[model samples]
Target: MARPFRRYSAGARWYDVLSGERWVYRAGRVAGIGLMDLQAGDVVLDLGCGTGLNFPLLRRAVGEAGHIVGVDRSADMLAVARARARREGWSNVTFVEADAAELDVDGLRARIGAATGRATADAVLTTYALSVMRDGAAEAWRRAVALVRPGGILAVVDMQPPTGRWRILAPLARLACALGGADIHARPWRLVARDAAPGSVREAAVRGGHIVAAVGRSPGEVAPTARS
Candidate 1:
């Protein structure tokens, strides 16, 4: 079934503000740099790309020669992304309106590589957005895995349930969501971590909480193990 796009459309304007506060803290730039190992001439897909907040960072990584395809279910969000692309004169970036769960992976692959004259992306980045997806994230991840060619990477960042005593911060997590127009307590990261292939999931502690960031190739390809 097609996912509801209205949920994100209504919140598009507020998405960036909420994400900026939660993820863009001290050392976030550094972490983003590390997570997005972009290369010149590489093609990238920014999934659940809200307001295209990650565009600048992605542009820097991919360089002028590469391209970024920002996909989101919200037309409002894509509008912001398109406007930003125009304002920045980034002709290489394109925004598409599509449900994350039902994205046209083959079509996108053709678009990204066709424009760049390449066969596959160097990386795919999804940040902070997947945790809130209603369902079908597993299929989404599987599609992501299939979209990239051998040796490419999938970088994901999302909140995790607090561990041990830090679980007390559950209220803060809810506040972060409330401020951002999201569920007060969504924990899709746990599901991803559980289903993720062993040695392919890494956890990064952001502020007082943790976010999972994983990188790997297609299921059969040998890729770096999850960093301990």
Candidate 2:
């Protein structure tokens, strides 16, 4: 557990290059965000948002009026994320450094309110970050879900062992997951299926099925004017 944090802190600068974003993991995030069906001016909460890799797509989905709150435990990683936002000239994003498992819900809500004029967001997303949370993923997930408005979107993208002919790449997949301190078997996407509004689930498997993306809506009526 501690080892992963150390890696994130020390290796964040090289993460986008070394984390196989182009060849593998990026597909999952792309698919997941697409399934989220975000709208312009929607506020999105990104849990465990390392280095803000999801910022560009989220920004596109939410547009200039929308706000993105990126939460991560690593200050170093958040620094990288901050740099990315600055480099991209994204004024609508905010970075929060806090452990997901022990997140202060009220504090986060207040923070969101301060930024977006609303205490909750229109969506919450976690991509390839939950398995690394290990046993804390559930608690982190609960807190994340709490930060979204009713009928808001939820997206989870995480890793798993490769299936079908892609099984030949199992060793490489394991190595990547191992190096990142992720439990490839974690299947964190199940959280979406378990908690999302009934019949709202949408799923996709990419990167030889080693990456799984799931999107669903929280229960209740989606506020017509839920956007910031």
Best by lDDT: 2
Against the true structure, what is each candidate's TM-score? Answer: 0.79, 0.97
lDDT (Cα, tens digit) per residue for candidate 2, span 13-98 = 89999999988888888999998989999999999999999999999998999999999999889999999999989999988999
**TM-score of model number 2:** 0.97
Candidate 2 achieves a global lDDT of 0.91
Write one digit per residue (lDDT tens) for candidate 1, span 1-228. Answer: 233345556766775664554443323334644655667767777877778777887888778987888878778988888888999999998677777788888887777667776656666677666665646666676676566655566676666555567779767666665444444245554543554456655555554554445554434453532210
Candidate 1, residue 67: CA error in Å? 1.2
